[model samples]
Target: MTASWPPAPLSVDEPVGAPTLLPARAYVRAEVLAWERRHLFAGTWSCVGRVDELPAQHGVTVGDVPVLLTRDGDRTAAFANTCRHRGHELLPDGGSADGRVVVCPYHAWVYTLDGALRAAPRFRDVPGFSAADHGLVPLPVEVWHGWVFVNATGDAAPFTVHLGELAGLVAPYAPEKLKLAARHDYRVRANWKVIVENYQECYHCPRIHPELCAVSPPNSGHNYDLPGAWVGGAMDLREGAETMSLDGRSRGAFLPGVDRRRVLYLALFPDLLLSLHPDYVMTHRLRPLAPDTTRVECSWYVAEGVLDASYAERFWDRTNRQDWAACESVQRGLASPHFRPGPFAPNEDAVQRWVTLIRRAYLGTPPWEGQ
Candidate 1:
């Protein structure tokens, strides 16, 4: 390692005024992945899952900790999933304790919907034992649009502040009111960042995703400024295409208030990849497992009355597999001892911005506190 960002920069590998890629080691090193898990994911507003996916279940795993998300009527709450006594899991692993109140399955300790300790078995006469101190360990949670996001440490910036102008940008679509049509899961054989970089750019679409290029011209898009913490933009649909299908045909009604012919793609920093089409919305949440492996959960959501998402799901699943194959190939190539990052293309502006952001975050922040 050196004084320079990413230890070494291969400026000679590409042209001047071009963005440099992150070092290969950053994607392959274990300690680097650990640092990202702690700083970039843990305290951040990690999207556990959507409200519609797990209808009655409230438990989720963020990083290594299990956090619970519960709703009572119009109210919602989040907290550590362990009971105050005996540290037993208040909710079974990845299962729900949903009802009027959360009951610890172990000792029958009970907690209110708001995570307040209500009953503690039969231990009554313990002097100075305060229920106030034993209330569930609360975690900050926000149900943005339709997605549920949680901040484990409860010290990160407020969810709205972190989102910035993102709310107003997508309000016209009323994504909160959208309904899930289909869901799919995959174990991607590539790093999380590789998948993200692939999603943000279409430079390889012409070669790798002919099905995608058939619907929308890969070059017919403009990148959006930082509306919030997210980075994304839109691509114009071809003359006759109504949505992003294999042949650019609509399988559902156009979304409410959507009159234009374009598709919106956004990487809601850290984890969520959001794509908004004329008639539906698709999202991919990246879960980094090891340095070279990631798990991607994809769901297609359509507005009310749009029916099922068979068209959209089949289309994107094929496209997603194509991108994943390429990413896995890139990862294999990057593993070589002499690999170096190449320059960013003019069309890869979103990829460039993402790389710069990651580089700054990695280099600007001290590796550890008080170092």
Candidate 2:
């Protein structure tokens, strides 16, 4: 849970300090991606899906690790997706099991929803093969604000520690009461870091994002470098703008305690992009597919009575495409042998800090070891 982040905004009139970016090989090399899958993604808390979206016996991939989420009695639970009988995958990729039990396709090994071994057909005579010792391996899981997250390594700090004081800042939205109203899954032909960097810095907003600029100034926000594993800040909305829609007007009723004129954007390391607005909350969950490809699941949650978010969806769909285009261009650009890593802009402090954290992880360095 240790991270380099900020909680509040710094009121600075001028941008300061430019840091060098990561090398090109980090983006285009398969070896780097392999290192990240093992060292970085394996140990971190990665979100798989939402509580409501999960089935009775759900299977998902957390980074490179396959995990299972299920309802054990009344509480939700997580376990390794591998079966003990000859090491068969319970759900293969990402899908739901039959009813409340997992039936391995290779062999008819049955496991209950909570990962308890139920039956191993035709294996009664196998020596030293006990069903008790073959239950699915358990993993640490936490359901925070309706999002279901699992730790692949089973040893990271609790999700509470991961949130720290940042939890208090997000409490005003009453996220647990919100419901998923819209979702968009994307496949971007770019490294995940490239997409993350685009989210962190708005220095390019003036040129590519005219609609966003009309609602909120690109450089009119403050960045947080708080005491948790996340970095975020808010940009005040334009005086005439009500929300991030085509017309800058709200699409639904305001959230419970979010009577504000700004929008919150932050990233929980590894892969969670959170944006809090007056009427709803939007989240982007990332999964790296290759060295140069990533899968993004973007979802928006609205308050109980507020149903539709068509306008909001349209606005972000356009904005998201623009951002993805930029990221894809950067990915293609990184393939050039002449392209050298550039220095981060003075306004990209958040990106620099977050990138530093990622670099440390990709290099297999613990957050507290080097600093």
Candidate 3:
């Protein structure tokens, strides 16, 4: 079925001169990265991975803080990966527990799948040591549309609350029923915010993404300043183009209930990037590793039972590499002493909004106010 060119109203108001990009220090300063680790990443709801990844128990690192994820009965739990006894890590990165209890490799301290302290080798002999008080420190964990999310500080708004209207905007895709098709990981030599800002705007599409611009013109869409953590909108595909594949063809049926001629892309602040197409969904989970380095994990999801995902995967794999290369170059440029903030194009309203959000989160003010 044919759809309108701009699927939704533009959230940004009348045209204004491009605002300046974030200062170079925001990308290269060690203190800036540390501030983000505490204020932005620690206090936000970050998409960790698919709930299926941790069938029993698994360990991961979020913004350098080791975390343990476990599936307990029908509920999922997240906790500090360190053992309370001696601060030793309980499980190795991505390591899984065989049964219900996760045992620390260092001292054999054991904890149940639900994060409750079950046993400590010799702690019972202590006069005042209490297993009840020494259970794994729990962090907030929630599952949305099959993806697991955790808040390191356990003080952010609920997952649904932070998502706001994004849940309804993507409801047509039925992401809840989609199954993981493939995954790829990349080590990008760029700041996490640089990567995020790049994804927030497509003004560079004509210069950097020839194949993408061929299927979806760089100037053919508008951005939405949606409420909550997400900022995105739909972009129309070229006439007769069925999907955003290398051949501009459809590899499978449209997602169960979504029949549209436009693709939706949303950057859920701090970590998750969601791209919704008629036939499949692509997500990028960003992990900030250092001031000038980031780890990106990308995954493709399609309706259950669809075997062939080569077209979409290859297309995006190429597109993602191009984006990462550009981001790394920008990171290098920002380090130059002569590099100064540049103006944002009218089409880059989303990037401006993203910068504003980051400033608000980290400095408690807008970027222009010297934050």
Candidate 4:
């Protein structure tokens, strides 16, 4: 099994070069909020909700925004789930139906599945109103396999195109076959950038995630890149660790179109991550709770019908708890008067790479376009 399931080579290893080191102060600055509004919340591809979570009448609340993601044949669509009139939320928190029309609770402003305004109450009397002009606003949504992503501002580059160099990084472990398993949410008394940087590298994993080190190789000990920008790098499973496929099949068993061979950890820009291992997959979304606080929600995934429940949850939950404790501690330390910026290890280049990219993008100087 080990011989057949060969691991692929890592991505390019050239240093990101000088004048590109990640700035430590960007994640929590009030000034950075404008950038997020311009680049991330409005520009980059962002996850909306899981595919499995979109069966019937389900919805996920992002800030004051309520988004409805639903399936139509093999495709999915997202709509701003708000009534065109009184601003009432359209669907109940979690419910589903096999129909195409959405009726608002307050005034029955019905909309087509494609988000066009279908009918409204008292239309004839509303002199200046036109249903065609008042349809539900559509968010820029793209579905890769079963994961759903949205670009809120309706102006981001095409989703796949924006993923750029990351496309091949996660090619080994198929993202489509993964399913949600377990979830844990954390409200941290820290800024959003701190959580992202903390997750960018495993340099502190040996000191922080001792148990996770037993399963996934620790990056600091190995020669893995720590991409400083919003980049995700993979770490191979320990040489002979116990492994299972998402379908409950042991390593090497194929699940139709999936490889099911190894593990992958995916970090999407701004605030989402997907950690795929041989045994299970984990998903995380970071919501800014405040200028000084952020909420981290995590969900684990397995193949469609497999149920290890407590066992799977325990393993990933332990890793998450460890991460939370470490990140919180780091947040507290950042308040200290003497902390300073530093250099990166030659081998631990992944986190540094991500930092550099993010800093450049936020400053409106993307990597591709020269300053």
Give the top-scoring candidate (TM-score). Answer: 2
**Regions of model 2 farther than 4 Å from truth:** 1-18, 125-129, 367-371
Candidate 2, pairs of clashing residues:
5-225, 5-226, 6-224, 6-225, 6-226
Candidate 1: RMSD over Cα atoms?
A: 4.8
TM match of model 4 to true structure: 0.76
Q: Name the better of 2 and 4 by TM-score.
A: 2
lDDT (CA) for every model shown?
0.78, 0.80, 0.80, 0.61
Q: In the order shown, what is each candidate's alpha-carbon RMSD?
A: 4.8, 5.5, 7.4, 8.6
- In terms of TM-score, which candidate is stronger, 2 or 3? 2
- What would the per-residue lDDT of candidate 1 be over residues 1-371, giving only the tens digit for each residue? 11122322222132365568888877888777776776567656788887655434377777657787788766667898888998887775578754777888889888888888888877677888777778899888888888888876566667776676666667777888888888889998888989999888999989998888888999988987653556777898889888888888887878778746899888876899989888888899988899899999998888788777798999999998898899999999889898978888988998877776566557543211111
TM-score of each: 0.89, 0.91, 0.90, 0.76
- With candidate 1 superimposed using the best TM-score fit, by how many Å does residue 140's alpha carbon deviate from the native? 1.1
> Which digits, one per residue and each the tens of the lDDT, describe model 4 over residues 57-107?
446554345676667666677777777888888875455666788888799
* Model 2 agreement with the true structure over 1-371: per-residue lDDT tens digits: 43222221211122245556777888888877775665456566787778877778877877678887887555889998888878877886678864877888898999887778999998888888888888889988888888877888776666766665668778899787988889999999999989988999899999899999999989897987566667778888999888889899987888866856999888876788999999888999898999899999998888888778888899999999999999999999999999966777888888887778766555445432321
Residue 349 of model 1 has an lDDT of 90
How many angstroms is residue 326 displaced in model 1 relative to the true structure, after the best TM-score fit? 0.8
